[model samples]
Target: MIRDNQKSQRIFWSCILPEPLIAKYGLSFAACNFSFNLMSGGGFDKVYSSLPVYVGGEMDSDAFADERFELVYDKLRKRGGVFQKLAVLKEQWMIFRKIPRGAFVWLYNLNILNALLFVLLKVFRPSVQLNIIVLDFTPVKKGWGANSVFLRLINMAHGRICLASSPLFKSQNSVVLPGVVPQSKEEIPVISNPKASFLLSGVLLKEISQIELVLKVFAKLPQCELHITGTKGDEILLEHYAAIYNNIHWHGQLPFANYLELMHSVTFQLSTRDINYPENECNFPSKIIEALLHNRAIVSTIHYPQLNGLNYFEVPSDEEGLINRIQEICELSKSDMYTYVNQGARVREIFNTEIWNRQMAKLEANK
Candidate 1:
């Protein structure tokens, strides 16, 4: 869409990105975000300071309210009360202040604000090229459909600025980036042993009450130890279900290195979601991908349709169905079990940095 090749462009992002990877695409980037904590944690300072878009420090609720940014969040949360509606006009004030006209911005999360902002750019600042990279699509709230006007507007605005990070996203406007998976330093020993461990990683969510069903099933697997990882979410509700089980271990959150190291040792992985969507535009359990990379089998729900052809044990997100499938996976033959480890090469076959570069090349073509 950028017909004028003579103009210069820089990437301005508001999300965590792989610094070294995104660096090759543009000369610099600006990390402008509204965070509640200092950006000092991790290598964020080094990554953000490497560009001009970094917004110095975190922005609390007061700072967000000062610019009526709270309204945008309210809209996303689907809970804009009487007070929020009165300040809708002030949303523009926030936009113009944060994003200058005629700027090139690569927004990481295409939330409620960015949808309206994209429209405003088209109407007010035609020169500003807005690209959106979608890594997460787990709706601000459950039951969110892609047909919504805000999401439709974003899809309409895509002209080389939309990149999908997962196959779950299906719009002509976007292309899924073959995301980077951590490569083991050496050949990792694949779990050929049946009497081994199980790993479940992610923040526990209320909508995902199916996790309790998984725990119940895990309790039955006396020979296998279940390891849960990641920060956030309430695991206490399932404590009663797990208390009777000695094989269940709550590892909480581990460093990136430690998580993957543990992932490689697990016998199989579990990915389940209690809720179903009318649309398939939601994230698959990333644990499936991790299990695949480590050459382990997986027990998953329908959310991960890519593994439909593979040897994974698929079940409904219900208590009885989960127990049945978990038991089925436990009873697989040596050939069938090994097939689960060898099958499902889709991620490696299609998703890679090259696919990402090729998609970015479409934008670079105009440049």
Candidate 2:
């Protein structure tokens, strides 16, 4: 499947995809990272091949999702299939020379393994216009800056940084990249279901969303059905909870497009990130962005100032608060629900394509 002219490709997008291959260019972390690096702004218009690794929180969550594969046949669950993972590594290796040395190489991550790969790619073609974008960051002691090895690497690199607008990392020349929401004519999903439906996506990490709390809170909603997706997110625990609740459907992981398309079938969306985590202080939730783009009313606990004026319902970071919010949403009349949906629809104008292109162009040093 390697194109001989692949090397001739000018722009290269580099990021680490989740191992166990949860969402291949879909609604999972893969899609979020892809959108930021390649799909959003003008990056997609140019010629580029995506290079992703399988590591970080994704790799850890994959362990929880693939626990069965690891427990029964312990050795086989070696991160991901060797052949599939090597494909990305191999793709990057083969296309090194084809891409101009000084051409833009947008590095979307700086994980343990990905950092090494970035080094190799830069060495292969040292003149790469390196630009790094970190989706999630945890500053030490609620401060904007952290004196970590990763931060040191980020500072050492002469690339522009993109993060959620905050005073914390301003010294790094950080640009606000809240997330791209196109003002597309695509109709907002029509939810005519008599009962409410909910979506829970992203890696089901205990340190973050507390998947069990969500499940427990969701179980209390008799008029609501919760649909779950995303990569290897604590499948065993999910199944246990699913077994107890008849309405909870575990769709596992689906392609991002498929996930979005299915929005019409659901009434509302959910984004839950524990604010207690140090990382939550600096990181913005892409799930919130995705829900807004889909024009669905979201019940979330994560805080993003970008949605400050928007009509989103921010609940307390607790199971009781989540339960109360979902109850409130379910109680809304059809007309009221539509009003909430339209409120989210208004957010599309906030993320203009022209504005995004300007930011990306600046990062690329485009005059």
Candidate 3:
């Protein structure tokens, strides 16, 4: 239903690439994060910051609500029911019918809406380039079929798949693209408070009980404090823990700037998950990278391949192991702390956003 003038030239780069690249090329991006706002600096912010971002989703908001967002949500809303299905079938013909074709069209996720959109984009604008960046194939609880089918459809469309992890490349059209960060370090004062505070970040509900086990272990550490960085007011855990533990402090969800600033003040960053779940085991926690970027020592569970031996305590499923590790970290000498911080710095450099951008540029050129 929406068609652009053929002669009005444009290049569509999909995926949440760095904002600098988007500004440099004057490219438009399709927004995929569930939220319409561009606050978080990871996926959605990277795209929404640069291009004429298309905000297509189940959510609704006034397109002109704030010039800061510059959004275009609900492109497919009731209009996409059956007519869109027909358009997908007649994709190539639709491209032939369109006026001046686009240079390239980028897609991020491969869900129901995206699959239909890709088909229509191909059919109506066959002459344009097609690039796809896959952050995750399926939802955390969902299995591989959703992703597998999406990759197959992408291959059929002649679009290339870019990934941040290895599991995304089961298809021929898939290409591995490393995720990046623009992290700089400062000499942080050692958190020498005898009561060492461990700041835990994430929505607590996903794995609340596992976190409770962690809390149980630390409760016994008389000289330790626990600061939880997520779950805004009225969480069940907040009410329950407040009564039981005098040492645990729930700061709720702080703005990212404040979160990073708070990270500098904490003694160590902590993450825990139930590895019995396949999805949890395979996940790459962004917080881990954030902690590393700040040159903070970590206490996290052993899950992903990249987490091996980075001074992160290999937490066992039981409470005793967690307790023992915390005790060991509590007694570490200044030299031991320095070695751990140095190791975290090495990992942080590998994920620097600037380094990631340069690598992506090279890959794009060679392709």
**Candidate ordering by lDDT (highest first):** 2, 3, 1
TM-scores of the models, in the order given: 0.63, 0.70, 0.65
How do the residues 1-367 of candidate 1 rate in per-residue lDDT, one tens digit apiece?
1224424343333433333322332321122211111122111111111111222222233433332112122231123354344333344345445555555555555554355556777777777676665544554354556435545554544443322234333455555441334322445556656545677776565344255666777777787688887544565744655577788887765655677787877777776665465222454444565567567777667534344445676677767777676776777787667767743345445433344434554653443
Candidate 3, residues 33-132: lDDT per residue as tens digits? 2122112222222122111223223432332344333322323433556544443334323332332464444454455545655666567666655556
Between candidates 2 and 3, the lDDT winner: 2
Top of the candidates by lDDT: 2
Model 1 whole-model lDDT (C-alpha atoms): 0.50
User: Each model's C-alpha lDDT?
Assistant: 0.50, 0.59, 0.51
Q: In angstroms, how far off is 6's CA in candidate 1?
A: 11
- Backbone clashes, each candidate: 6, 5, 11
CA RMSD (A), model 1: 9.4
- Candidate 2 residues 119-229, lDDT tens each? 666676666656666666666654434336566565545554454654545345457666666535667654454358788877778756678888888788756898887
Candidate 3: residue 138 Cα off by (Å): 3.8
Candidate 1, residue 283: the lDDT equals 41
Runs of candidate 3 exceeding 4 Å displacement: 1-70, 74-106, 139-148, 151-168, 171-178, 183-195, 207-209, 232-234, 307-311, 342-348, 365-367
